[model samples]
Target: MATLRIGIIMHGVTGRMGMNQHLIRSIVEIRKQGGVTLANGDRLLPDPILVGRNAERIAALARQYGIERWSVDLDKALANPDDTVFFDAATTQARPALLKRAVQAGKHIYCEKPVATNLAEALDLYRAARAAGVKHGVVQDKLWLPGLRKLQLLNDAGFFGQVLSVRGEFGYWVFEGDLQPTQRPSWNYRSEDGGGIILDMLCHWRYVLDNVFGKVRSVSCLGATHIPQRWDEQGKPYRATADDAAYATFELENGVIVQLNSSWCVRVRRDDLVTFQVDGTHGSAVAGLTDCWTQSRVNTPKPVWNPDVRQTHDFFDDWVKVPDTTVYDNAFKVQWELFLRHVAGEGEFRWNLLEGAKGVQLVELGLQSWKERRWLDVPELTGREGA
Candidate 1:
């Protein structure tokens, strides 16, 4: 069998999402499974070099994952001709400069969402990558999620005839790090450090809305910093200047209305940490991170409002659980395999740098909407591949 070893520079992987999702669950898992197979009987094997600020921590991570390479010098890694692909999962604020350098070095680029703090930088990065003629991509892992996959299947099957509206509820109570240790990093709460719920989650929402439902036309958003004070990793008190919660509404090109509520200040009472409910003319479905439940028009139950008495009906019993007909792999891993194939010229990759810029545009517009207290039109980004 023909084996193609592809060198990849993995940067900012010391962070939680970078370490767990990109490295361990995706890349390492691919290695464990003998790499991605091609149709022409060749296998594309990834050779990843971990790049981070802390040598000791990165070295430990590399050793733990059975990786042979680890480096703290990004310039050294970029100088190597063998490492053709540069993957960044670094802080959002640092992404633009890192990507610019990688693109200048003529390396294929892949990275996490919110490509930049604003739309201009994001578009600039995209343009630079396009000018360099390097393969580029952004992470839209939610589309590969099992629950969302099921929703896609249902849409494909025409289960939701003339899909009407979508409601997304995401996030949960993140401890203030005063008494209980915070689950998320301290940087996520600092605006100067590129921290905020809108910047972080809106990117995910934009992709999900565009790919699954329809292209977003306009947006209305309201943001809040519910918990003003919190403790950092060092157990010291700090003012949380960044917004922790967002209530947003989107109007799609297809006339579908979408309302999304994202917050870290609220407690979870839903089926999962994040849940989406879609209602159509013929049916409705609720999807969590890994599960989906559907209720058809025929199965819809009629209920009478009685505010004076306790309701006896179990409202949750009407929807039927969607079954998993096929085994699902890790969402990030699935995307990674696709990217590998795309790089090898075996598949098409639509989620490119321009798509990432669209996500950044949504975040920028959302922030503008919040500030102006009015609906903002999501203008189409110019200078894309087709445009």
Candidate 2:
């Protein structure tokens, strides 16, 4: 079997997500599985060079993964013609410039989402990638998630007949770094560092809503900085300027209403860290990160409301668990495989940079909706809106 070697320059992967998801789980696992098989029966293998500003951290990450190449010089790495793909998981503000440079070097582009901190910058990256005439993609990994995939399958099979609405609950209480060490990075709670749940998570919800249910038509959002103070990496306390929580309502073009509550401050009493409950006339399904439970019209339990009396029904027991029918891989890894195949001239990749820009556009509207306390519309983008 002939294998096509594809060189990739992976930047900022020394960080948490870049290390765990993209590098270790995705690329490393891809190597172990003998690369992604193309439609024409050829296998595509990634030879990635880890790049970052911190020499020690980057080198250690590379060594831990048994990767040979590691570099602190991004420019030098980008200039290498052998490395045809450029992937970045860097800071939001630093992403546009880095992507612009890489595309100019004639490399195919792939990176983590939010693409930029704003819509204009996000559009600019799309424009640059298009102008460079190289293939481009973004990390919309949630689209391939096992739970979401199961939901998609149900949707495809018309299980949720006449879909009505959706509810998404996502978050967990993050320790304020004093009583217990914070699980999230300190920068996550700082607005100055390109942080905030709205900016970070609205991007995720945008894609998930648009792809799974329907295109988001508009948004109404309320944001809050629940805990005003949090300790940083060095155990130093600082005022948190960014929002930790957001209660958002979305209207889909298809008339499906969606309510999503995202917060780092709230405790998770739900099924998973993130769960989507899709309700329909004929049936309803609640999907977590891995498993999905469904209550069909035939099996759904009816309840009576009486405030004075104790509840008689067990709501949790009403739904039937959807059995796993297929083996599921890491979501990020799945997206990476599709991107690799797309680069190898296999098929069309719908999750392009422009799709990523749409995610940023939603963030802008969501933040504006919060500030104004009113619903704001999401306009369709064609990547030619005078960026």
* Cα TM-score per model: 0.98, 0.98
lDDT of 1 by residue, 324-379 (tens): 99999999999999999999998789999889999889898999999999999998
Model 1 worst lDDT run, 10 consecutive residues: 378-387
Candidate 1, position 275, lDDT = 97
Top lDDT: which candidate number? 1
List per-prediction Cα lDDT, in the order shown: 0.94, 0.93
Error of 1 at 202 (Å): 0.7
lDDT, candidate 2, at 71: 95
Candidate 2: 10-residue stretch with minimal lDDT: 297-306
lDDT of 2 by residue, 1-387 (tens): 799899999998978999899999999999999999987788999999999889998888889888999999989998899999999998988999999999989999999988999989899889988888999999999998899999999999999999999999999999999998999999999999999999999999988998899999999999999999999989999999999999999999999999999999988888999999999999999999999999999998767778999887789999998998999989999999999999999889999999999999988998999899898989899999875
